[model samples]
Target: MPFFVPVGRRLSAALGLCLALLCLPAFAIDAAPADADPAPIALDARRATISLDGRSQQLLDPTGALGIDDIAAGPPGLNWRLRGAGERTVLSGQTALWLRFDVLMRDTQAHWELELARSGTDAITMYYRDAQGQWRVQRAGDRLAVSDWANPDRYPVFSLDVRPDETVRYWVRVEHARVPFSGVFQLHDHNTLREQRIHQQFVLGAYFGMALLLTVVALANMAVFRDAAFATYAIYISLLGLSMAASLGVGGQFLWPNLVRWNQEAEFVLLPLMGLVGLMFVRQVAQPRRIGRTLDRLCLALAAAWLIGIVWDQSLPSALSLQALSALGTLSMLTIAAMLGLAWRSGETWIRWFAVSMVPVLLASTLPVLRNFNLLSSNFLSQYGIVIAASIEAPLLFYALLMRSRIQHETQARAHALERTEPLTGLTHRPHFLLRLHDSLVRAQRYGHHSALLLVHLHNHAEIAARHGREVADRALVIAASQLRAVARDVDTAARLDDDSFALLIEGPVKPDQVLHTATSLLANGLRLSPRLPAGTTLRLRVVAALLPDADSELAQDAAAHLEWMRQGMLTLSEEPRKAILRLNF
Candidate 1:
């Protein structure tokens, strides 16, 4: 029984380690391309060259190379053609020759015919490269022979004798076709037969996968933080994914075939867009650090420039404006400065990582700007910088968010727990009351505002407790706290200052008449504990308050000091009893 696996997409022929495991055989071997009939071919002894740029040469073996290998096991064809010197380097027939092509198709094969006529008809052998980067030479190539006679795979070792000044020509034809090889799965393509195709697919797939992940991460961050910066970054990632796909020619070829013409424009938008969002996110989180302010300003400028570039669709203008990435480099350098500042002011490790991640990418973004303006070559610096940077960046950002939230929420929970709780009534505590007072005082000082503070006492609260087991007195206090809480606004903080004495800070920047009216409403409740208190004890519960203009800083700044003054100036019992009120000038 033969075991097998499945491949998903196109595979490149980096070194002809062509082994694909069949999970379910794709019963169409005979359906090989109709034009596969080979034409008598001859080798042209010409080689392509690159001056400074380097070309990659890899090894070829069929079984397996590394764990990530997607090709199948067990040799099937004559794989001993040529062994290149890379990771899978294999030398065969002691030494051999190689065939290199730029773009290899799936439906095509490089068919070779080596002739021995000039060499005295010596028996010659054949070889090819396997999927595991190994060289496999076969002296028997007759299984699927399309020739009338079984082609000689190899000649005996000394079968060839050379005459002086005589040269013999050998014919080697390749019957190669584009066959998709993704994770042991095969598909059809007229162009998948090249070694480089596999490499390109892996690279493209990694980028697309990363872009998608970053996009998802950005959205999740935004939803949690509700910050525009995160949302902007998310949009940038999505655009970047599209942009990268387009730039790599994959989007035009497979995904968005119709949008081929928009490739440059997509690059234009995505390149700057990522920076725009990154700048915005940085400005928001890092704030006005020394370099941060500068970067933020630069981002703002780039956004404007991009908008302008979009409005006027000329390549040069578009090119010139993107030089803003030069600004990004300067800006990113400044970010380093800012990170130093932030580190000194607040020790956050994530800030350092963020700073480091920005450098290469910011530099990369600058490259395209230079290239677009003819300052450099378009071949090196690409629109894919952000995609790559973002690929590495998103995880760092998520870690940063975790760090930020971990510390932030811990501090927030502590402050809320300690400051806002009332000791006696478990209501808003003295600290919270003081905070509210300070805020109200500041507002009043700014606006010449008038506000009121009321001090309430359980009149004869000791006498009532003396008569009622003290439990009823506790009940009365509970009732009062509940009533005050029920009447409180979202801003109000009610606090118990002492036994039987509570302070109510009421914001009354309104007219003096409205202040008086609001006071009347509060006192009208009659403490509501009449039923909970002694029926005939006749202990009076009264509210004593003083209202002062908020601008009276000296009278309102210190809670104990100012409140003491207000208590001293408390109004006596008005004839209406509960309606007692007083108004003062700042």
Candidate 2:
């Protein structure tokens, strides 16, 4: 306290001490061991292949202004980080990435190729020094036409030439603007690479062939059944197959090799379009209105949003577009998941099959999106996951469609049957009976085939109803219906035309004698006693048979007029005798 220094001098001393403390660590770090250069990967007769991903170092060019010279000069503080074990090099944001690795050749005769195990990069440039000590550049990617690539292939490939016992350092510049790029770097001999490509192509061809077969089946169903569900499924599968082709680089390599711009943009456009169509297919098949109006509207709204996303993706920058598409894809999957839950809760049993089929595809489809978003590393699962999953999903989905179609067909059949048949007797009602008669008459006229219509009248139906009750009268009508059905053959049509009149159309190849025999059988059956009727009550029937479509008859062509002729014949027979059979030509 007694030896106080000046205030300015005290502050200066404390600042000097703080500066020295900060400088001390910097000096110590500089004096510490420097990081050694990574050893060159050796490729010899015993080991002709190696994975460059583990041996490489990566540098990010934020502004994308760095050139080969700048990278070669080893600028200070531009630290190149080593790739960790099993780590994939991922290109993200708006930045370009540079990868450096060295390969030592032991066998001079072997031709080598470096392969980037992915196909959707925007541009990839490989830089190396040749024997003459000049920098050589080779380019390949979706941005460049496949025909113009240094090596036209499903993946970016580069030829490597080096002398025996020489170590060649390589610099790979990867720029993917629209999406994140993550891939494995492999050095394979030329023959081995070709074999790999052939195997890959075979597997992909099998998958696409299966997809095409399923799509053809769907289209055939659409045409035959005229169902919107089948049509929507066909479109969805087609777009999904095309999108897979584009993502796998098969489209660029074989489909449209010269369309560089379209090749670059195809994946982005097709993926969302697939989602849109897939939603439509789901809605058409699910018929969510059976569950609730809210679910139906949700499906429509989701489809519209996906459609909007397809257009919006084109307007955004490459990175932003990828991000947006990835987000939308996630939302789409979530929407499907939610629909599955709602369907389950609402007891949509058919949707259970749909939900089960979606599991593998959903899991497989998510890997690529995660890889695109840099949330997952590139691997076999991320690259070919959809292909494997689609192979399983396609067949399952086709089966689901078949089940749904069968259920719908059965439902429609039941509804139609209810509309056309009489409720009490389960026989063709009056309107449908006339329609069948008209069809039969037209066929008989066209083919010159003989056919007959028999009109049978219950003579005492009103007398029984007045004596017993309406129930007893209904029982008599039912018993009468059973007799007519028993008398009719498989090719014949039976109908309850009115309160007491029944009609039977015996289909073609019949003569008047056969018609007379049929009429006598009906009269005999009508006189039989039935336990279902009142005690001591026997049915009395007046029968009239009309042979159809007579060449000289004016009313032969008209089914209604011919049926009226049969009725008049029945009325005439009623006045003449009891239990009499009357046969007429019409």
Candidate 3:
């Protein structure tokens, strides 16, 4: 859709050239016969001969044949035929000089032909549009239109055979590329009673299911990752797939019976919404900085617009706005692609790979967009692209998660190695106090039954270390551990929680006051902290404690609940940690 402006630009240029030619002076275009012989020349609009040439023995139009102009809004009967070339002339010539008189109008339609005289023999290899909206060749007699015969927009070719004096009524049928509704190929003839209905049901059910499932999965991942890119893209792709499928007629058949009116509006509305959401997704995924803020604004604005439109659901302008939204979304994609060029130049390999993933997704989805817009022919692939794209996209999400985990692991490794631990004192250095405390709480749950965390902050620790030197500081820490070990029950756990703060996990029924008193006594005076404690100094200690109600399997979960209490005071405890305790019935 973003690409369409250029197409329109080219169309404008072409229209200018056409008007120039149509209004200019009359002249004869040299007619080159297929066999190097000569053929009659038709009227040229520039020559001002609007009259038909009666010399070519023309074949009448088929009774049901609608001229290309009749379908489009210009010259109603401009789509006509030239007949009466001999069977030899039709078949023996290596190639025929066919003139395709394409009528450009709303979307557009085209018709033209070569005079082939004889009954059909070799297959007529003519290009047709598949449901996916790409141009492809089909056998003349092939059973077509499961996908509306979407021929690529190009010059026309006609092959026909006529018997001697026998009239051949070859039809040149053209329609605007089938506009996909809800991922379904448009239908031209639906008069069949049972057959069309059955096929309609099966196709609609299948595509709708695929689209719905895609939507759910995309939304689910968005919820999990909270990745704006993922959420935006998933919504876009799912809705695009859904809108495309519904537009195609096959999907909508289930919701609405074989009726003309109901299908039109639904297709119109979904097309733009899909484009809006999808473009937002691209901006996030691609991280095109230039487009990011703009896209973000567009998404917000479009969302509001859609809400308004939904309120006025009865309007066709709302439906047309979808096309505009789609164009806006396409702009986002182009912006991303441009940024990828920078991502490559910067040598960001991961971003580069991610950019690669988006290319295929865009190309695949584009076929359907082009089909829906009547810009390209039709095909059966409207829903298939989403399935393929989602498969590719799912892996990218996992890769992102893996990259995050790898980064986290490396950070933790560095922290573990760099942690400052006192080898002699077995006390954590100040630098590692927080990390050790966190790790201690994490590992202590195995035996922390009815556990109480006791934080003993020794007063005058620096003075003693300075007076006795490192030797006395070492001895004091060793002695402190030993004294605590002697008093601590076998069920209790102890750690020199910090350089000057030892932590005790008292089990069973120990009182907080008892722990505090013992901490003060063990840190006795003459604990000569640097001989600077004014000679006969006693150690003062402060204590903090946290009590747990039970030991539990989900101690981590419980720990999370108690984190706030731990942060608030010198001495803290919580009952939350015990809530996750598991009891064996045996």
TM-scores, in order shown? 0.39, 0.77, 0.39
Any idea how many clashes model 3 has? 44
**Model 3 lDDT per residue over 1-586, tens place:** 5744332234335434543443232122222223221233322222211111222222223342433334333255433343221111111212221222211112112122232111111222333333354444433211222222222111112322212222222223322111221111111111222344466556646655655665576567557645455456556656656565554444333344333344445555575566556555554554546534654565456556655654454453432544554455445444444544444454455565555555555545554444334343222343345445645655564355345335456777656744564565544444455443445455555545344555555555777788867666556566666555666667665556557666555554545455555545544522535342244545545544555543333446344344334334443222333221111210
* Tens-digit per-residue lDDT, 290-364, candidate 1: 544655565566557555654454344332344544445334434434433454344467665555445445444
> What does the lDDT read for residue 499 in candidate 2?
98
| Index of the highest-TM-score prediction | 2
RMSD of each: 20.5, 14.0, 17.3
Q: Find the candidate with the highest lDDT and give its number.
A: 2
- State in Å the error of residue 100, model 3: 17
Model 2 poorest 10 in a row by lDDT? 25-34
Kindly report which residue stretches of model 1 are placed more than 4 angstroms away from their true locations once superposed: 1-195, 289-299, 313-346, 373-388, 411-586
The lDDT for every candidate, in the order shown, is 0.45, 0.79, 0.42
Off by over 4 Å in 3: 1-214, 217-234, 284-330, 339-354, 368-376, 379-387, 394-499, 504-586
Q: Which candidate model has the greater TM-score, 1 or 2?
A: 2
Lowest lDDT 10-mer window, candidate 3? 181-190
